[model samples]
Target: MEQEEALDWTIRTRDPDFRDWDAFTRWLEAAPGHAAAYDALMLADADLPALVPAEPLFAGTPANDRGAPASRWRWRWIGGGAIAAALVAALSIGMTNRADIYTVDTRPGEVRVIALDDGTRIEINGGSRLRLDHNDPRFAALDSGEASFTVTHDASDPFRVTVGDTVFEDAGTIFNIVRAGDATRIGVAEGEVIYNPDSDAISLPAGRALREDGRGLTIVSVAPESVASWRQGRLAYDNAPLADVTGDIARSLGIRIVGAPPLRFTGTILLDRDPQRFFARAAPLLGVTARHTRDGWILKERDGPQS
Candidate 1:
């Protein structure tokens, strides 16, 4: 059959029961050259459908047999076909891979705000990566780490977020989900979110916090400012654990809290200033000592003078 006919057959054979499956398979495995030609065309068709359909297939088949000797011409055509196929396939593979990859990345100690095409806004936390498929209307997969999402309401189609094994249904709400250990910790700042606690619906209102603990949803009233403070350059804590407070400071200030543990603080500190001074001032009150490190701060128990 003509090369154009073969290509057309391949294009039309997207159906499984197209009866030409066997023929296509035969063509695919015919020879290294034949296989290469088929793969090149197939990859091009899959990768650049618009371009492939616009270009003519099998364009330069000689009209007369009087040109070169039959055997030499046939071998030359085979070599040409192989080269053409390899080039197309290579280009197609590269383009397809590049286009298909979705990367949500953040630098260490840097929170990045990204706006999605679908009107959803995402704030990726420092030292985190979230892979998302915006094209999938039913779901956006947060493949790793933590992010806060301000989902644009679309009732007809649910905007679902998948973090680890737990899936969150955006009830047209603004919420922050952090993947910690094996659980998905969630704090809702606006609207309402339905938590699937053991495959059941449990509603959490605004200013509420909960976590999927593998057992069920543990709900509690949370301090909204503390949860949303990362959006700003400040760390707000309301009677939070010393360890937890230090962790938050570490994430925001790009420092390490190494000391006699953390002293509980329930106030806000402007991070634009030296974080070391903040730690130094607070350490005595919390019975800890603040020491500046190369990239961050470390805390240890205070030994002597109180200043």
Candidate 2:
């Protein structure tokens, strides 16, 4: 039970948006060997060093980015059988090294550009997981996170990106994709993306965006330049869900934004790189009041002034 809980905490704390440090510290203090067990498990894995992408670009770093006192190795556990979800909490030993594949995992609030052998440039957002093949060069998979791709298209082979079951085939253009939780979003700015060309293919051209969630796929019109605007220190939205907006804020700012209003937002917000400065202007626009907490900021619906 202790090891299971330790493993669970290990995975949770590594999450880009993880908070609850006090609670985690309490758990660490609960038993003397608890921290030891956690440390031992993490040290054993020693997550491979992330290779620096050529021609990297820097972005703002989030403040108060605290977590467990451990190394920066991420682990992904995959157990065979029906109850694989449960195994995630019980074990943290599924990281694999393949000769053909490599992964680039970004830190929260970090933005950088990486190049492929084919000269395709990808600007990856913070807290993202992207896998690339050193051998194939054309096969890329975004396990989770967000990235903008400027593909070096090939008519014969084409560049492919796998997200969940869907594959985005580049059709000679620039586009951005994001997979947050179960929801996936893609937008085209200068080129086109074939949403699964094999069967039920959807042509996604410039000035358009698509979002897939539990309710299904929703296609909407977006300003072409606004696509992946985060690359330029801004976030643009059009009737976007409150949860998604806040989630994006948390990811971009690298702090745990703890609540979402039951509302959708339509506007653009500048990423000022400073939490307080950003909220001072953004809270009014979002119609929320940001209250500071030990864990992070809590966004509450504006309900008049306090007594």
After superposing candidate 1 on the true structure, give the runs of residues whose Cα lies further than 4 Å from its correct spot.
1-101, 143-145, 212-217, 258-265, 281-287, 294-296, 301-307
Residue 214 in candidate 1, Cα distance off native in Å = 7.7
Question: Considering every candidate listed, which one attains the maximal TM-score?
Answer: 2
Residue lDDT tens for model 2, 19-99: 666677678758855655565445434432121111112223234434343321122222212222444322344323224
What TM-score does model 1 achieve against the real structure?
Answer: 0.59
Clashing pairs in 1: 258-299, 259-299, 259-300
The lDDT for every candidate, in the order shown, is 0.60, 0.75
RMSD of candidate 1 to the true fold? 16.3
Candidate 1 structure quality by residue, lDDT tens digits, 119-169: 888888765667655355345666545688888888887677777777778
